[model samples]
Target: MRKSLAVLVSGYALAGLAHAMAPAAPEPDAPRTAPQAYAGLGVGLVDYSGGGSKASPKLFGGYEFTNKLALEAGGIDFKKGYGLYIAVKPTVPLTEKLSVYGKVGVAKSRREILPIAALPAAPLVRKNDTGAYGAFGLQYSITPNTVVTAEYERFGKKKESGAKEDVWTLALKFFF
Candidate 1:
């Protein structure tokens, strides 16, 4: 009786270990979620404060590790100039389909200046500058993988001319 009881207890212990090592099953009724990575393209108007306003185009990509945070990088062509930027975005959800976010980053920009023919010595100017950038935006999810956003962004002033740039953009993003 004692030997039989020991064998039974050992069998139960091995069975418990097997059960603990088994992989968990996924829930079939879980809600759909967004992908971890995405890409976006946008076009809008850039207002160079006290300078002028012109059409601008931008391309960007990002990765979301969690629902509330992401890292992004992009390039923008603003009128006669262009810039490359990288930013961190922190987001807050207001509803199931709407959210707000803020971005802070750094940018490297190249500005082209036309020659001043009226001046005594007419010379073309090209300047490369680097500065901080910030933005705030609202996003609405049209589908699990698509989002639309409207945002306002500000680029820091140029080192030489102290001129700042701002843009208002509408963007569409897709996650894969």
Candidate 2:
């Protein structure tokens, strides 16, 4: 019984010593460092929209409002009568240089389609358009504000045509 009592007291003393040597815990209300903001410009080609395959150029700009939130804007074929869009994205970082994001946006597009002609008739083209779309994409940031992207976007059907515009694109982004 005496030997067991001595061992119990020694164990308690060792535990006390270990506790005294441990580091202090952080305060619960301390402010942590904020994540960096990132912005960029991008360009790419879009296909599977406007009634057929078309080569479209795009430009993009974005600001990271927080680590997981961003606002963006840009146009496709800005120099011509092309599609225009603006979007907001929620991004989640999966690694130091990789993240995935989804986008929602408004788009304006103007497209021309060739009209079907009968024999001995002249071929003509007509214009079709949409003023808005829902956009979505996945982004892989090679650097802090630059990314390689694959995107799919959908716009409401055009007037007088039971057709919707949806395109898949591959793009490169550059940070500013």
List runs of model 1 lying over 4 Å from the truth: 1-35, 48-51, 158-164
Residues 1-176, candidate 1, lDDT per residue (tens digit)?
Answer: 99999999999999999999998743443223443898999986775635666768889999986768889888889666787778999989888778999999998887766655488367657777789988899998887778999998876664443224667889999877
Query: Taking the candidates one at a time, how many backbone clashes does each contain?
Result: 0, 0
TM for every model, in the order presented, reads 0.73, 0.58
Error of 1 at 60 (Å): 0.6
Candidate 2 per-residue lDDT over residues 46-121, each given as its tens digit: 4443444556666666666675787777666522346666777887777655667777777766654445545436
Model 1 weakest 10-residue run by lDDT: 26-35
Error of 1 at 45 (Å): 0.9
**CA lDDT of every candidate:** 0.78, 0.61
- Whole-model lDDT for model 1 versus the true structure? 0.78
**Backbone clashes in model 2, listed as residue pairs:** none
Task: State, as a TM-score between 0 and 1, how close model 2 is to the true structure.
Answer: 0.58
